[model samples]
Target: MERLSLNQITTDNWNMREAVEGCARASIPWIALWRHKVQQAGLAESKRYVRDAGLRVSSLCRGGMFPAATKSERQARIDDNRRAVEEAAELGTDVLVLVCGPAPDRNIDDARKMVEEGIEQLVPYAVSCGVRLGIEPLHPMYAAERSVINTLSQASDIAERYAANQVGVVVDVFHVWWDPDLYRQIARANGRILGFHVSDWIVPTPDLLMGRGMMGDGVIDIRRIRKAVDSAGYTGPIEVEIFNRSIWDAPGDEVLALMKERYTQHV
Candidate 1:
């Protein structure tokens, strides 16, 4: 049987409880929880609802954003990630995804260094909590705004620098589809592949940051990437993580239903 999961931000307006119930009703198998919504919906109760609904948690939404201007700020980011790891453990989630932080002042190299240092600092703590950290490579367009880890090679290098099996990368196809190095890097990441997130890229992407089409609605060759990951031995959930306001504004259940259908037919 195939497994399914969702990123909480896809249903931006839905509270965690609402999202869980909606997915459960749609018979989707899992969810990737966001920090704010976890707190808003109360972690304990959220876990209960998910378990009660017999839903699996593929991974937790995040624990990165490691770059900062000062020592205090950087330390604060590490502390926050520690908390995120603990939260993932509490929820019985196997992976905690990391959106490796962006530059504080547009210095990409500096941000990358900070991401390395921060992950090194947090790994021991995360290990203690029994939570695996999955670094995510955002699109190059996000190099300045969201993450410094923008390539599979870069992310794999960092993961190898720390723990081979304990730390890995979450490959979101929408972010890495244009990379000429994706196939080779995915091969390199063989055993270290942590999670796989899916969504399509619209040609005239309305919003550079948020416009994402459904699996079969745009130009992404999702099955090719899926085949690559599967060949590389990644038997993880293909998590749907679209961040479109137009989709969010619709009935949450409708979106989830479509997500399940597409996961079966297209993705």
Candidate 2:
């Protein structure tokens, strides 16, 4: 319960107030917030709500989607990222997770270039706001529609280009568990790992984006990965971020209880 945190998407239907209250009831120490949830609850009010509930914001989920057809659209995306930085800062969180966007014409190489360049432009603003950026690597299944940053190594390469305090990598078990080089890359990340997300990867996943399983419910060697992250100098919150439809439909308190139980046993 001390280092365990809940990501807001695990309870998709709960509003910011409900989520904060739920965390308080469950004795969860921290929470990772999604942009939409904060926006809907009013950023200032949401911050107050979470703080009042004695919950810390672990990291703000999503600030990047850098690919676009036109230059203006790309700039628009960067502008949105700046806004995300502001929101994270206002919410009193230091880590802002980024999902580097895919290329416009299926050109993975070009998309990769765009993501790097876009982050280079955003880093100054992020630093000025006193927030750290954690670029997240999505699974290859999302290569065509989501992030082009598909591996911890790629994310580490980008994060290495900046000061570790200003930029880092996010390790989400559900996304990078299949990589044979996962442990190696995690060690390479060293102290630059800004966030550690824990979720299971079910074999027969039905949805590409929302099919994540709860910890211990799938085949991932979560404890092994947790050991690696801890050994790599990350003493931060171990966030539980599940997006399964069935989990969301269950009662929020019940889901949180299960999360607590699983964290004790599995994580």
Candidate 3:
């Protein structure tokens, strides 16, 4: 059986800590944490709590936002990612997920080039820090402002371009559910898939950015995707990464309860 992990419910609210603790209480062994929250809680304290609670840090929530017009801006992101690599190593997570940034000038091709260059620049540093970089291909809707690497093939291509010192891709069903080449890309990803994210797509999608549904609450064939990913030799945890305001507004414990129930029964 694949284990479940709750990501960063601790910072969602003052009450969120209870929800996260409840998850630990439930014996869910893994969690992926956000950087800002970890900082706020104090890294040492956070790590200590997680370890004491008996949980494994799956992967850190971020690392790559590398497309910027100015050299200074780009370098700043590079520096940040380098630090992120070190942080992931300290957290003892298996990977650091990268959201390859978009072009400020709307040049998609240029943004892609920047992503490639950024990863190339950071590879050696990541290797030295004993951390792997997991490139997450965001949905095309986010292609303008958030991420430029919008396909698994693109992420895999970049991974192959760099020599094998732990560069891989994160496959999020919410992002790639619309892709025509998902299966082929999964095969291409092979063992390079270091992370897997799950969330459902709402019909009429009230908010393009938020409003993600829980498992089986929306239209995505998540189990099919899971099977494909498993076929590709990725037996890692299926991370639930929903950023829905409705859920966030609910009591954190209630939300966590619903999430765990649905994840167990449906996913």
Candidate 4:
């Protein structure tokens, strides 16, 4: 319970102020914020809400979408990432999760190189702003549209290219639970893990992007994965990041209650 952090996406209907207040009311010590919600609530107000509620900002979701057809477009993404770093700093969190986007064309290899280059460009700014960039690999199902980095090993490979303090990997169970080499890659991450997210991969997955279930309701061995992350020395918040539409449609308080119950039982 102490390590549990409610990610804003887990309560999709709630705005930043409501999410902050909800965390405070639930005695949740930490909250992982999304950039859109922060932008909606106004950054200063969102920061104030978290500070006043005494809830820590676990990590800002996200700051990477590096693939583009033109160099100018890629540079624009880098510029936005710098702004994201500033937002993370203002929100008082050191970690910024990066969901590296898919290929601009069909050349995934080129897109991957672009990802590395973008990270290289952003690292200095992130480091200056006291932020650590967390590269999060999405599930392979999202390879065509969401993210090209689809495996923990790939994410770790990118992170290893930079100083550990400047870049690291974010382990999200919904994305990596299917990998046979997950445990080995997790072990390889070691001190390079910046964040850990927990959500289940439901059997007969309904949607590739929004099929995540509560911790106890799916096929993932979440506790085992949590143990592996713990062993890897990530003592940070275990953020609950679910994208299911049904969960989002439910009442926020009820969703949070169920989340806590499932977290304790399964994760």
Candidate 5:
């Protein structure tokens, strides 16, 4: 579990301070941050606090909801993403995970186009800011409300259009395990893979978005995928990003412990 990283959302109830301290006490050297939690602790101070706690920021939580009804609203979201880029700079994390939200005004094709175009605009700026944008392909369950980019192939399609240092595909197991071409696509990513997230999806998920299982608690072969990622030349952090409500409701310290144990034994 040395490469294990605890994503803040796994214990969403804890404030940024507790999350940092929890990782420190558990000896977990890395963590992934959510922007909202960072704002609650204040951006500059968040950076100082994480550094003081001796933790590395694996990736910043989010920065994409590109489809909007009007041009102004789209521009507003783009502006917000720019701020996300700046926040990532302050937090000392190069990768910013993006959940390209579904669009209300158009079909999947158009919504995806918006995502591609949106990231294209941010790529140059992200390069300048020294941040890499990670395009996360959420499960197809999120096709209508959460994200239009639902496959690693689609994300790779976009990432192939930009430099890997500026834009890369995020391999979150829960989202891509069902793809028949997952391993092939992982190989195709080669050096373009950014952050790798580990989590299991229950056989019959109670909640599409929030009901994620702990490692080894579900059917996914976590280590197999990790090996595929490793084989693809991605030596970065393998973050555990579980969004289950019960996990979040539990004590943060205990959650961290179990996450580490599961990562050690299962991942």
Candidate 6:
């Protein structure tokens, strides 16, 4: 439980201040924030709340959606990611998790190229802000609407293009646990892993985006993956990032208490 960090989305009912205070009350020590909540609370005010609560921000939830039909649209995404980088810096977190978006059209290959180019464009600004872009590949099922990059190997391919400090991969067990090449890719990621997220994959998934289960509630072998990440030399926070509606509907305190229990027993 020492390295546990609650990704705020797990307790979706809590606002920014409440989440920060919740973390403090639970003695969680670290938080992973989402951009919308931060914006709703006012970035400066949110930063102040976390700082005052003596909590550390693990990584900003997201900063990438680089695929668009037009060059202008894509550039707008780049600009928004720049703002995300600034937000991450001000919030005292150095990792900006990137959920590389789906293809704008059917040309997934072109969309992927755009993803790489977008990272290429954003790397300099991220580096300037003392932030690292952590590309989080979504599950292959989300290829149509969520993220085109669908594996740790793909994320690593992109991260290797830039300096390890400027770009890295985020491993979320819910997304990568089924990969046959998971262990090998994790070994290859070594020093370039920026974040690690934990969530079980329900066997009969009810939703593609929000079906994630709390640890030990589903079929994932989370501890094995956690061991692999540790072996890869990433001694960082293990963020519990469940997106299940049922989990979100539960009381925040109950969720936190259970999260701690699961972290001890499962992760």
**What TM-score goes with each of the models?**
0.97, 0.98, 0.94, 0.99, 0.98, 0.99
Return the TM-score for candidate 5, rounded to 2 decimals.
0.98
Q: Scored by Cα lDDT, where does model 3 land?
A: 0.82
Tell me model 6's lDDT, rounded to 2 decimals: 0.94
Q: Candidate 2: TM-score?
A: 0.98
Candidate with better TM-score, 1 vs 2: 2
The stretch of ten residues in a row with the least summed lDDT in candidate 3 is 10-19
User: 162-266 in candidate 2: lDDT tens per residue?
Assistant: 999999999999999999999999999999999999989887887888888888888999999999999999999989999888999999999999999998888
lDDT of each: 0.87, 0.93, 0.82, 0.93, 0.91, 0.94
Q: What TM-score should be assigned to candidate 6?
A: 0.99
lDDT of 5 by residue, 1-267 (tens): 567788989989998999999999999989999999999999988888899999999999899999887788888989999999999988989999999889876577888888888998888889999999999998888899999999999999999988777889999999999999999999999999998999997988888778899998899999999999999999988899998989989988899888988998878
In model 2, which runs have C-alpha deviations exceeding 4 angstroms? Answer: none
Return the candidate ranking by lDDT, descending: 6, 4, 2, 5, 1, 3
Worst 10 residues of 2 by lDDT: 201-210
Q: Candidates 4 and 6: which is better by lDDT?
A: 6
Model 1, span 1-267: residue lDDT tens: 257887888888899778888887777787888888889888899899788888888899789999999999999999999989989999989699999878999678888899999999999988888888999999989888789888998999999976766799888999999999899999998888889989899988989877998888889889899889888889988789998989989888888888887777766
Q: What is residue 95's positional error in candidate 1, in angstroms?
A: 0.7
Better of 2 and 3 by TM-score: 2
Give one digit per residue, the lDDT tens place, for model 6 in 1-267. 668999999998999989999999999999999999999999999999999999999999799889999989999999999999999999999999999999999999999999999999999998998999999988999999989999999999999988999999999999999899999999999999999999898889889888998899899999999899999999999999999889999989999999999999998
lDDT of 3 by residue, 1-267 (tens): 246777674226633245347667666677888888777777777777777777788889789889898999999999999988887888888599999988889688988998999999999999888888999999999988889899998899899876544798999998998999999999888888898888799887988877688888888888888888889888877777888877777876676677778887667
| Candidate 4 lDDT over residue span 1-267, tens digit each | 999999999999998888888888888899999999999999999999999999999999989999999999999999999999999999999999999999999999999999999999999888899999999999899998989999999999989988888899999999999999999999999999999999998889899888999998889999999999999999999999999999999999889899999888998
